[model samples]
Target: MKRTDIRKSVHDFVSLRLDDHQAFADDQSLQALGFDTQDIEDLMFRLEDEFDLTAFTEEEDRLLKEAVTVNDLSRFLQKIARH
Candidate 1:
């Protein structure tokens, strides 16, 4: 999928989960919007289902831990979708 599509999907999922309709900035941190670790995990599962992704690799999980912003998750999804 295209990068913009991936980004919009990420934003929609997050907004739905948080019930927040504000526009998200690329550098905006999810934590600032009240995302906890559990929320992140849930989001990951949703993304996997939406993108028809297989199980994540160890390296990819590690990269996920480093992801703090919408842009980061969007990029991560884009990278995995290409694999």
Candidate 2:
């Protein structure tokens, strides 16, 4: 999928889960928006379904721990989508 599409999917999922329709700017921090472990798990499943791929591999899981913002995840997803 295209990067923009991936970003949109990510934004849509996050917004839907949070019940916020506002567009998520690239700089926004999901953590600041109240994301927690459960939310991450939920998002992982949703993205896996959306993109037909796995997320949060053991390596990626470690990387996820440092991802504090939307852009961080967007880039991570882009990388996965490319491979």
Candidate 3:
């Protein structure tokens, strides 16, 4: 829920390699950050591991494109953890 916690969690998922956190301030588009397609998979896996959530299916992965910020991704993961 807190933006700072969400940002921290996402940065940890990326292994802190997202070179442009400032530009991503309000955007969660992985392509905009130049993250390779598989990098997104890796991040999803990291989130799974971090929060002990089930893996997202291929369809769910595609849905992540709509998530546009660390906060968005965090909320997504929170939804995941809840169910």
Candidate 4:
């Protein structure tokens, strides 16, 4: 999938999960948008389902621990899709 499409999917999922339709920047922090641990996990599961990923690798899990922004997740998804 294209990077922009992945990014849009991320944004759409986040907005839908949060029940917020407001536009947010790629650099915007998920925490700042009220994403708790559970919310992040839920998003991950949703993304995995949407992208047909079996599961995240250990290295990817490590990176996910450091992810803070929408762009971070988008980048991660892009990398996963390429593999």
Candidate 5:
């Protein structure tokens, strides 16, 4: 999928998984949506499988350390896709 599509999917999936409407691109702090660290890890795994990429070390770091927004996750995936 294109980057935009992936972005939308990430946002939609995050919203649905977290059961919140506040997971739009602008919503930072996914944890506020009830996504715990485990949930975030699961989401990253799902995204990895969906995108068909072998995750790098930075992927997890980025997800855990700095990916506060859906757009952050989208950009991370786009970065992985590019590589």
Candidate 6:
């Protein structure tokens, strides 16, 4: 999937999950958006189901841990799609 599409998906999911209307900025951290560990886990599972792909391969888990913003998740998804 394209990066832009991945980003839009992430933004939409987060906004819907949080019931927030504000646009997501690339630099906005998930922590700043109020996503706790459980929320992040839920989102990871949700994304995995939606994309029919696992998000927790050892390397991907490390990548996920480093992801702090919507853009980061989008980039991760883009990379995953390649493999």
How high is each candidate's TM-score? 0.86, 0.80, 0.64, 0.86, 0.80, 0.81
- Record all residue pairs in model 1 with backbone atoms less than 3 Å apart, i.e. clashing: none
Poorest 10 consecutive residues by lDDT, candidate 1? 54-63
lDDT of 1 by residue, 1-83 (tens): 88888888898998887765777788999899888877887788798789998556784577558878888888788878877
What's the lDDT for residue 15 in model 3? 43
Candidate 6 colliding pairs: none
Clashing pairs in model 5?
none
- lDDT tens digits, residues 1-83, model 3? 44466567886665476665344553566676777657766776777677677845864576456555556566667667666
User: Which pairs of residues collide in candidate 3?
Assistant: 27-68, 28-68, 28-69
Candidate 6 backbone overlaps, count: 0
**Candidate 4 stretches greater than 4 Å from native:** none
Model 4 per-residue lDDT tens digits across residues 16-69: 967657788999999998887677777877987898865557845764587799
Best candidate according to TM-score:
1
Comparing 1 and 6 on TM-score, the stronger one: 1
Q: For residues 21-40, could you state the per-residue lDDT of candidate 6 as single tens digits?
A: 77668789888888876787
User: Which pairs of residues have clashing backbones in candidate 2?
Assistant: none
Error of 4 at 23 (Å): 1.5
lDDT score, residue 22, model 5? 53
Ranking by TM-score: 1, 4, 6, 2, 5, 3
Highest lDDT model number = 1
**Candidate 2 on 24-52: residue-level lDDT in tens?**
67788877788886677667667767888
| Model 6 root mean square deviation, Cα atoms | 1.8
**lDDT of the candidates, in the order given:** 0.81, 0.75, 0.63, 0.80, 0.74, 0.73
After superposing candidate 2 on the true structure, give the runs of residues whose Cα lies further than 4 Å from its correct spot. Answer: none
